[model samples]
Target: MELKKNPKANVGRNSSLYFAVGLNVMLLLTYLGLEHKTYETETVKADILMMTEQLEEDIPITTINIPPPPPPPKQLVTEVITVVEDVEEVEETFVESSEVGQDDIIEERVVSVEEVEVVEVEEDVEVPFAVIERVPQFPGCKGNNAELKACFQEKMQEHLQKHFRYPPTAAELDIQGKVFVFFLIDKYGKVAKIQTRGPNELLETEAERIISLLPKMEPGKQRNKPVGVPYSIPINFKLQEQ
Candidate 1:
């Protein structure tokens, strides 16, 4: 068959013909690429499903149960005891004789008796006297009660001159105080149980020493009998002003 072409239509158709042909070729290539991608995806999915089914059939599952350990054995304990015996003392018995007389038939009676006595022994203790004659007296003390207090004060002054050593801090700081000491005038009139009532430990110690060195005096008299008496003394400590 012979195709007839118009001159005007051919002139207009030639310019767009090349562009239309290029567009159709691009569309056809895109459709073919999409179909190839779809086919590859479906093939991969089928292979994954088959692998999953084979693995599920090959793997096996198991369940196990374990029991706990047994308890330990019990131990027994034993204790032993010992006993001792005691001995008792025996007592002695005495025999008695009886005599009978004629006429009235008088009988002499004999009596048996046990006697026990206790004896206590006391040891005599001789106490040594203090060496009062050796002690140096204060200038005004004449060994009287009033003089004794002055003698103690003088002894304390002597002690401070010889042995009144104090700590460096206390000495440098000029620490000074008064201590009240209470003591007993014993039956022999010697100082005993001297104790301090205030601070100043060094002063208290020196005061106690002075009191201990005091000589025996006539004991305090109450109703004309020697009786214990309480005595209080104040020891004053002061720093010499330079």
Candidate 2:
């Protein structure tokens, strides 16, 4: 069996067109709705400026009477006379010429030995340890120049070891460094001009204290003459590991 329908009666044939038309209309409506904008309007009022005519009052010019300035005062002229007193006369002293003439007689005066003063000046000479003819002798140290030098070093080390004491403050702060001490042995075999350079004042003070305890020794000699000796030594301050 075959079913026949009229050409105008076909609903599916116009359904696609109707759907496209409806879709297009819906899209247009959506676009218009999305594109629509509303702006708020505020009313402004304008005012007109009116120029009003003003009346000007006439001001009268008043005259003021002022008296002229008083006349200048008159000055009187007076004469002055001065008198000077007489000054006393002074005598001029004559100076003799320092040049001596061959014909001039010179008096002979005897100068006694006791009448003339003799001044003796002692010179301060400093000699280096290496170049000194005789180095300062430490107590209980005796030898030749080379041997004396070695003995002195050994004795110095012994002395340092005997008196080495770390500063309590420096140790607490963990301060460690090498202190360079420069001291001068005077001609009288006494230590002087002791200076120290270290990382901290405590270390320097300790080093100075140790150096100050050094026993008096024989003064250094240069050319068989006693002289001040300048010596430098280094003291190491180190912390032992636990």
Candidate 3:
């Protein structure tokens, strides 16, 4: 029973106070140990005011005499012109009023009609190859539907094969590309408006030249009327490895 002494006394009551004191001390130490930011003091240097001597300007009062403006020029007087009537007197003939018989009455002078030239305007209508009633014919394409189309294609291929000249620069540089050419056959059976698209400019130029050299063919007809035909074809420019 003697070993258990002060059992009813509170031991943990002062521990909180000690912890608070320790925490405050640690905070104070931390605050002291941290690098403090220094602010530079604003230096207000008093500048001595130098009195500058002011130059006195003597103002001279001068009176200027302005001449009066000249009077305006007198206007020209116009003479009154008297208008004299130059009427030629026609002799008065008294004719008694009588019945206007067709044979006795004088006929009024008739005005002749003036002739004018009539101008005619012609516009070429464009039609596609697939939809036109009568397809365009090449030089030697004289046949019906399927045969005509086949003959046209055959003639076109033959023409290409004959006129297809590879550009010297393209062959020299080994440049190869496919050029798409779009040409129009006018109503007069003349090839016009040739355009080309390709990877190379030289290739495009060559294709356009070949297309432009195409001979005049019979203009395509739609509903038995001649029309312009828009045809597009692709030509390949390939360099052979020799």
Query: lDDT per residue, candidate 2, 1-242, as tens digits?
Result: 99888888877978888999999999999999999999999999999988698789999989999999999998888888888777988899999998899999999999999999999999999999998999999989898888888888899999999999988888899999999999999998998999999888999999999999999999989888999999999999999999
Best by lDDT: 2
Question: What lDDT is reached at residue 105 by model 3?
Answer: 60
Model 3, residue 148: C-alpha shift (Å): 1.5
Candidate structures ordered by TM-score, highest first? 2, 3, 1
lDDT of each: 0.60, 0.93, 0.88
lDDT by residue (1-242, candidate 1, tens digit) is 99888776756657688889999999999999888843344444444444545434556767687777787776777777776666776788876646544645665877555444557874322222232322223344566545665675665567445654554565776667877877776555666777885565666666566666656655554444455566566766677777
| TM-scores for all predictions | 0.34, 0.54, 0.51
Clashes of each: 0, 0, 0
Candidate that beats the other on lDDT, 1 or 3, i.e. the better one: 3
> Model 2, which residues run further than 4 Å from truth?
1-115
Ranking by lDDT: 2, 3, 1
* Candidate with more favorable, higher lDDT: 2 or 3: 2
Which candidate leads in TM-score? 2
Candidate 3 segments exceeding 4 Å error: 1-121
